[model samples]
Target: MTRRTVRIAMNGVTGRMGYRQHLVRSILAIREQGGLDLGDGEVVWPEPVLVGRRAHALEELAERHGLTEWSTDLDAVLADDSVEIYFDAQVTSARVEAIKKAIAAGKHVYTEKPTATDVEGALDLARLARDAGIKHGVVQDKIFLPGLRKLKRLIDGGFFGEILSVRGEFGYWVFEGDWQAAQRPSWNYRAEDGGGIVVDMFPHWEYVLHELFGQVTSVTAHVRTHVPQRWDEQGKPYEATADDAAYGIFELAGGAVAQINSSWTVRVNRDELVEFQVDGTHGSAVAGLRNCRVQHRSSTPKPVWNPDLPVTESFRDQWQEIPDNQEFDNGFKAQWELFLRHVVQGAPYTWDLLAGARGVQLAELGLKSSAEGRRFDIPELTL
Candidate 1:
């Protein structure tokens, strides 16, 4: 068989995540390191053509990455016979339309999450890709985190036997753009652009829950917009029409329960942006972004809470640090490498469009549950 190098046409390359996460961290750094090692006869490296709206910005990015090809026209890139794959890191609202066009143009697609703003649109895109006989995938990077991977290993090894409940606390204080310049895009605060915590993050939790415990059978959630207004990059204050925080209770398929608190207002007092505490009949595990601690039934604590007395110690003394056994890689880079292997070597990539659609389905359910003030059952995707 001839060795094939995948040529990628990257749309939204000038955006925040496009430039920082996908382009710089995943593509350029991986290319500089001589491509990703598939651990066999196969290897994959992306040869990307930057596509964006601004010529100067595109040209500068191309020069910085040593890429000779840059185009202001997305249609022209899609028309090029040399480009076999189209990658999209555009905003959530624009992703579906661009992906549809790419599929229509006979190009494989790898796009960012929340593949579409709603379940119908996401499912439609998946169906289109299947009909077109094109490979399609969405970015599910949370499962690749070292901490989460370690948690998965423990669960697989029965460290958490007969898991009862799981708790996830995720947050960071997003700058108001006026004072410190927002770390995320301004569009993320606008509902018109499909910007909201529920849509943006439920996909991540869906996969994480599926990977660690079991699939979510139902969800009851309450979402709120903590800050009513926020400034954009230009210091223009805009009405925040999206939810900045969401509190959700998930019922797992196996009778286990899980709670997730996702927010943009909390200050990080811990070691990472996200952390999980899983409790089981036999043991429990606490996992952060880079480390994990386990406490068996033998070491389980018995304590009583009292505001007048000293705080009771939980499993602090029994906390064992998880050692680093592999090289550190960004979550996005790991997912990108896996996608490349899936394309080049026929490796199994579970983060398909169906999985992405499932995420949107959950988010939609969450919204409905919040609106109705009741728990909602998640419907299975027919596709």
Candidate 2:
């Protein structure tokens, strides 16, 4: 009996998500968990070689992780036969070229979302991976979230007899890299860098909607640039070339409607960083990052709108909390484990390049809708 160890070359290993999500949380941490029990002792441990742009930064990160293999040359790493997988966490603008190079080098790939900034580019990469006969996957971590997973179970169990609509509210005030260091990368504020709330996040909603409810058939969107300028890491001003907020209406395949409001300018008002409310004919469920609550018609409360009346008690007690049944790890980390299993043990992983293309398609359609001031029909992604 032999154990298979997958050697991974991590591109953009020093970036925010690259460091936190892929490296520390996913590969190193999961490896510590003895490679995410895939049954039958067919464990997978990542023999990772960190690839970055700066030798100093790469070496520092390697030392932090007690790893010695770090490189500044991506092409050199790809040319190495021992690198069976090329994982990308590069900026969205850089992902396409890196993934293409990895595919050309005959290595399996796992990459961060938007796979490419545009639908055609994403489709091309998907086709390239298919033509090359290499395994490829994208990160769709939100679907694997524990709270969302439970909500999915409820939906699957008919708790929502017929889902009428889904409302998603996701946002937080991203720091203006000037006065307060921006929580997100500077590129996220630049259009050329593939940064924009709509482009970056709609794919997440698209997949979640498709996976939990149904496929999106059409989209009507309104995008806005709330703050025209934001500061970079050095407290220098940079004109924001991308939109900060987007509101979209999606018509799903089953006639279910979904509304998504994604922004970088809103303040958090709830327990979860991201919250969703699914309303059905029989009941309604509200799910956040930390908790889920349900309200049935039988237990529903009536409400009246009044300007002078106290509003605290109307809907406060209408829903009951769903008990937390499982410990939820970081969403990115969980997806990483799954990808490893999918690669090593052939586990059912549907977040492939095609799925990524679907997300890009929706984003493309959203952009079209926003630009033309008309609803756009989304054609299905043909693998």
Candidate 3:
């Protein structure tokens, strides 16, 4: 058997998403399972060199995971001849410069989105990767989720004949951090730190809509900061300048409309923290993070409006849960394995830097729409 080892420089892995999803759940999990099999007696193994600003934290993480490589020197790691890939999960504000430097150093790049704060910067990164002739990709992890996968399957099978509309509800109440500690990082509520629901979440919505229903043609939105005051990690109080909620209506290429409501200050009243309901002429389906329930035209219940009645019928019981037919792995890990295969072998992977740039474009337009209190058209980006 032939074994191929790819050296990956993982920067900013000290952060929450970086540490849990990328480091422990993905790369380390792959390593623990004896690497990935690539058929015909070939295997691909990953060697991760954890990179972060804190040496002690990196040391501790590496030791806890039984990993040998960890460093705080990003420049040195980027310049190393043996390093095959450079990955960034740092704050969005710090990603562009680091990615540019990695491209200049002749390393393949992959990152978490929104690729940049603006569309131009995101396109520039794509152009840089294209000019350098290095493989690149961005994480669009939601598509690989089990519930969404089932939704995709139903769509593929024409279960939703002539899809009419889609509604997405995402977010949960993050504590004000006075008596209870906030679940999310404080940086998520600070504009200076690249924190805002529109930029952070609209990107996911863009891809989900385009990949499933159609390309979004225009958007109308209203964004606002619900809880202006919040406590930080050090028990310090600060003013939140970034938006906490975004209510938007998007028109799709196929003439379908999608409405998305995202908020960090809202309470959950649904089956999951995130859910999307798609309705069509033939059927309707609601997908959560891990579960999807559907009701067809034949099975959909009919109800009469009566203000005086108690309305005792169970509305939620009409839809039936979709059965799991296959084993599913962590969404982040699924994307990572595909990226590793793209690097090792000539695999068909299309989620490139350009696609990532599209996400940024959607976010930029969403902000414009919110600010103007009007609809903004989404134009195709060319690089």
Task: Highest TM-score: give the candidate number.
Answer: 3
Between which residue pairs do clashes occur in model 2? none
What's the residue-level lDDT of 222 in candidate 1? 97
After superposition, the stretches of candidate 1 with alpha carbons farther than 4 Å from their true spots are 1-3, 38-42, 312-315
Which lDDT value does model 2 have at 258?
Answer: 95
lDDT of each: 0.88, 0.89, 0.93
Give the clashing residue pairs of candidate 3, or none: none
Q: Between candidates 2 and 3, which one is better according to TM-score?
A: 3
Residue-level lDDT tens digits of model 2 in 209-251: 9999999999999999999999887788999999999999999
Clashing pairs in 1: none
In candidate 3, position 29 carries an lDDT of: 90
lDDT of 2 at 273: 83
Off by over 4 Å in 2: 306-308, 312-314
Q: Between prediction 1 and prediction 2, which has the larger TM-score?
A: 2
Candidate 1 C-alpha error for residue 239, in Å: 0.6
